[model samples]
Target: MLCVRKSYALPTIILICLTYFLFANLPPGAESPSVNERTESPDTPDQANDGRLHFTKKSEKYPVSEYIPLPTAAPSPIPQIQYDFPPESWWGRRQRVKRQKAVKEAFTHAWNGYRKHAWMHDELSPLSGDTRETFAGWAATLVDSLDSLVIMGLMDEFEEALKAIEHIDFSTTHATQINIFETNIRYLGGFLGAYDLTNGTYPILLKKATEVADFVYASFDTRNRMPQSRWEWTRSAEGLGIEPSRNTILAELGSLNLEFTRMTQLTKDPKYFDAIQRIADEMEDAQKKTRVPGLWPLFVNAQDMSFPDPRFSVGGMADSAYEYLPKEHMLLGAQTKQYRKMYDAAMDPIKKRLLFRAMTRDGKEVYFPGNIQATLSPGRETLEPQVEHLKCFLGGTVGIGAKVFDRPDELSIARKLTDGCIWGYDIMPTGIMPEIMYISPCKHLESCPWEEKKWYKDVRDRLAKGAQLEDLTGMAKSLIQKHGLPPGVTQIADAQYKLRPEAIESVFIMYRITGDQELQDAAWRMFRNIEKMTRTEFAHAAIDDVRDPHTEQLDYMESFWLAETLKYFYLIFSEPDLVSLDEYVLNTEAHPFRRPTAA
Candidate 1:
């Protein structure tokens, strides 16, 4: 398998955002209008307006135009949830481990080029001077290293990386949005994962994670909070007048909240718990303010609260964080319960409407939602923009449907959605999954930057490959019909193979929940495929760029996704698993720094 080289593997790292199907320009001949597809543009942000007058007009003095500014209010306290690791908690143990070691190799390999104070890269490491990807590259490497520390019970190694996380600061001008890398995927998981592994001894990770989370916290037009998106800095506190992406808050506060929630429990610190709850409340506020329950716009502006584009809404890209909903756990306390209610409420539609369940209009069992434009206002759109949040919520609703009031077919519907996503052929040529795919068709490639003409050419030169689309598709469908979607996720469209892994680990969970052999077989195949692609260091799946493919060590380090994929897989295959991962993983915006507080 090809690795992230000395450079890649940090995935969707450095520069991460969304423009779903921007390249495909719509799939081939699948142009039937969707439920919410408007004749006006269905791809960008303005489509939400459709000229209808807003239900409740804003104050005459603060009339809303393109964006709606936020009203200042005192910060509220966090809520409480409770839990204990149940027997079934670690269901996907097998899947998580198989994938973990493979991905760990990728990170270890990437670190070969690790420098002291400067960033490094593969293709462009020598071109001009410093590349933003360089910083993103190193941050991802260090982030992965930190993960090893947590899971391997080596807090000492984690602390070394922690120092870099704390002391190292990038020049905002040269890198622009590149440092946004740390907050992308692995960092959040590693930090919070530290606490989970240490049996709550790693409070520093959570506390420090919060401090670092402030980097991209506000995202609107704020002087600094707004991100350097599309090379454009959100100049004012108004945030380009857009609602922040769901991932944005989730990565920062959401991920941090997970850590703080744990810290609160470990140290019994009300402040940590308070912080997590406050973020959850804000997420709720953001959700209610958005369009339809399922729609998750990519970015929003603050000046007039106008939305930009939800299509690859940077933070809310894939459904990686879908599995973190409230569940019974040994460590989670009242925080789990409170989180469950809000998360359950927010995720309900996703399970029912978005997950690729048998009930889907297209019956293949995949349930990736097309972003909609029903937001009441712009700011709201940015805050809670995840198409699958509904499906995730549904999974939770079904997992405990007895209490949540769901339908009898909840499991059936959820299974189909998950299956369809995994079976969708258009998802990826890698036979794995890309970040995002189209429900319909967007045949043009220029619309998307990453998948543009340049990217495909890069893929063409890959050294090794395995597995065909039919194999994965067949297995996904079979698994779903036999068992069902897991309790916490929606479908991962295999039709296009885009956003493929979003549904990977959860499928293993489904099998664990029901103790079904068919699901295990499906998981076994996924593991085989990943291992088959393993190169000297990491799995081929770990490398995004084929031109520079060569499984490196760093790629494998924080391979949290792999960790999750295999861990879950392992648990399903292994008998009598421990239920919860001693190490909890938060696939969020991984920040090296702690949350902000006055010095």
Candidate 2:
């Protein structure tokens, strides 16, 4: 049976305020259209306006113009030297084919487990053989894995999944509320990605994608048109008023551009694109006003479009928001320039402020991106040395941004960052990167020698400040004797491995961009380690700790384990031209969206 949580009831006072805000803020000529009336725009030519006012009067303030099919400008051609692949003979084409098949087999094992144990649920608990609904009980794993199946040529599985998708009613869900960001990327993005890959041969894919997108689009029906990042569809369905959350994270509100724009492209309804574009406009205005000039804060107030928190990171709370900039530019075939402008603005500070080199025991010069806690005073921001496995995706985002925008220097940084994530995997006991850890950063970007005494002292100081004496002693002993942690790793903040795809995601991008055979070899080692450590009788499971080879297996398996992690692993070994970076731009979820043709 599917899990159903009780809905959150809105406070009466807040509801009254929202009602007045909606009516009072209506533009002079704009009728405050009901949510149902605002759901669809009239069908019209690509460039022609539908002769409707879709937004509040404040919509005129949007920095980006409305949807119009502009003639795509030819992108600057990539230099041939940028792509230096190992010749087919050098890598042995037969061996590559075998590896690709192995990855497919791994995917199939996981998929079959989901089918047998948790078919219509969000995830499979591989160990205990239970079903879990992390998202709405909508077969998230099935929908999320759709494109992966198509990419791997699992036509039989794809057809089976499509049969199930045909019956999914997006209008209602067991869960009272859904994460707007996760739903958009996994379900909506999944449908569109599969549609593109199959060249619309399956109209059901687009039909389903449109259905999911419409459900998502309704969340943007606020006075300001900014979406409630976590939307309560049940309340909206109940005819209770809904408003955007006063507190929301950057990625939640900002990462919808790629998926929403693609929806508009396919349906010729500007409503989807218009909703996200309004977000972009507000973000553009907010970018320069942030404590860090180029970057936006992690937490935002969607109600008034304010940045309440001054913390910034290229990591969790703020990752995909920045990631989508260059991707959105490529998806539009370089027709949109604001995305490029935003990309440049953010990358400048990210290179200087967030990215740092780690001083390793072997004196290897590798870079990792970190976080910043900003103060109102200039030049007083605190740099947090903690890094998340999720941040590893930055390596790929940067590499692709470099290629798309013709920034060669950033590509070099991309290589070092990719290597850093690989080092993270190689250093751990299970040969898989942990969810999060703290590192001793080097003062210099290019070179930093390992100083044993300094590293020990820094670790001791950090432990002494917050830890109990016995706790500090135990941690010190464990760091030296039990954990056998690599130098420069101050602490394993989160030891669990969640079967994340970010590290491999970067490796795949590096291979595609540079044709680096070394990356392929590194990825193979990662896959072997992951398979050995996490494989269960049923399917793969996330482990308790990456530092223990015999760690207990956790019950839950994320959808990305198959949708992204294995998909990237398979593509790394498959033919280079398959899902070519030049042809398609992948969403944060690793679903590949076909790019518009460059003129």
Candidate 3:
């Protein structure tokens, strides 16, 4: 789950008075510790050891001096074939029908569990048959799962959730500072998606969505127009003019355009569009000044709008910024070249700086995406190449961006990265990739990949002696020793899988684009593994570690497990005509938004 800073539970009047007192005395350009700065909590030992189950995981700052620079040799691109709409005839209509039904059944089981044990709560802890309130007491899982319910043709459940939406009072304020980005994507996006799915028949959904958006809009009252990462709705904005502290998260600002911009079209209110447009422009402008094009530092100063350093990764804090680029262009009907231009500019740097091909112990070469901790020095030496499973979402994002922008090179890069992610799953004991891994970017090592390398043990011995290993704490030493690695060259930095859907989300998009049967099969295998491992008496619970899949269950069921993972699984198996990608673009939360008509 995404970590958020929370305000102490205080009476509404006292909280409002405190806010007024704090911000009232601040001078122009004087920084106050805003929610954005406080929002980033250091990784707890558990998070560092076993990664969280969400894409919005913790962001860590690595020193600039600890990286291997990118190889001067050109990256070998994966070949791409022209994608035909109807992929293949191997899976007959009957098989597809069966697969879809099975997905629905699984969803039904999970949903029924939620209703039975943890109805009207943020999420279900299937292990304890209890509910947890992470967000406002608004039944987040049900709301997030709205469009998926309709897509699966679960009319009874859809209606049940619909009635619940009618009674949801978004006007309520709480001690927990609502994370505007998450609330917008999962809840507001969910509402808008369900409304569109139902042909806008449910105006109450729209009304509730607007209420939430309106309540959060106060956070954008800053002079720089960046929204504070979190806000207490209890405090009135009448006298408070405190902007985000010196630092604001890129993902929080960059990911807002789709949801809020769509709201503008729906309600015909420019406030929503105007608020995000300025930030979008800032993102585009920041690219021009960045050392690596299309990549922005994780944090930027809210007052000066200056990015502090050159640390870049398509995970956690920076994940959604790149995701929104092509999406923004598509959502705006490709009329605006700005988003496409930003996306294009970013890809060259991304591929050059972040792509790596590593050979495992068995002499099989695998390509993977890695983060670049860049430096601004004239001869910048530090360029760490590491991978987070969350970054795997780039596979699908890049694929979609390639298709929309007609960039074959981008598609090729996507193919390589997606294959790498699948490789992670293929080699895992439970057939699920861990949250984070590090790939060996050891290029042209003298003793590695010699012509005499015939056995797995030989490669393993060479790598163990030659390549710098990633698992400094020996978490994956046993696997490394046993597997004798390069083609399967991966160190599980964080072994937990918090029911994340990025890899599967990529599989869905890949199948849709390439009509690759293997991708579909991969999705099926993943779904089955997830179902088998996560099953509890009431509902599925997230596991503490994917390595020990069934040993222990984390007492939490994140909303996204229902919203994105199963939804993508269902869509991949269902008929292509069910939810046409051409007709809609799914937000980060898997909520489908109708594409806007060409302006």
Q: Please report the candidate that would top TM-score against the real structure.
A: 2
Which candidate ranks first by lDDT, i.e. highest? Answer: 2
- Model 1 misplacement above 4 A: 1-138, 148-174, 177-185, 200-256, 260-290, 293-348, 351-409, 425-500, 533-599
Clashing residue pairs in candidate 2, if any?
none
- Cα lDDT tens digits, model 2, 1-599, are 22222356457655564344333433112234457634433232122153211211122212334453433366544322236555698547887888888899999999999999998889999999899989887889999999999989999989999999987767666565668999999999999999988888999999999888877776776678788777755444433345677678889989998998888888888778778888998999888888898898888888789886878898897899988998888877776678889999999899888889988999877899988888867667767888699999999989988888888888989999999999999999899999998888888887798887666655765444565555555556555554455678877888999999999999999988888789999999999999999999889999999988889999989999988999999999988878888788899988888887744
TM-score of each: 0.49, 0.87, 0.81
What does candidate 3's lDDT look like per residue over 1-599, in tens digits? 22232466457755565445334433223365557533433232221233321112122221122322211233222223224556536657677778778888888888998988888888888888888888767789989999999999988888888888787656553334567788888899999888877879889878878877776776676666667666533222222233564666778778988888778768876777777777877778888687666678777776678887667777878888889898877777665577878988888777766667655555544556666666656225444546677877888888888888878666666766787787777776677777876665546322346232223332344335455446432524554655433243444557777888888888888788888778888887888888888888887877766665455777888999889989999999887766667767789998988875442
> Number of clashes in every candidate structure?
172, 0, 7
Off by over 4 Å in 2: 1-87, 466-479, 482-484
Off by over 4 Å in 3: 1-84, 87-91, 237-239, 361-365, 442-487
TM value for model 2: 0.87
- Arrange candidates, best TM-score first: 2, 3, 1
Candidate 3 lDDT: 0.70
- Local distance difference test, each candidate: 0.36, 0.81, 0.70
CA lDDT for candidate 1: 0.36
- Compared with the true structure, model 3 gives a TM-score of 0.81
Residue pairs whose backbone atoms clash in candidate 3 = 53-498, 359-486, 360-485, 360-486, 360-487, 361-485, 361-486
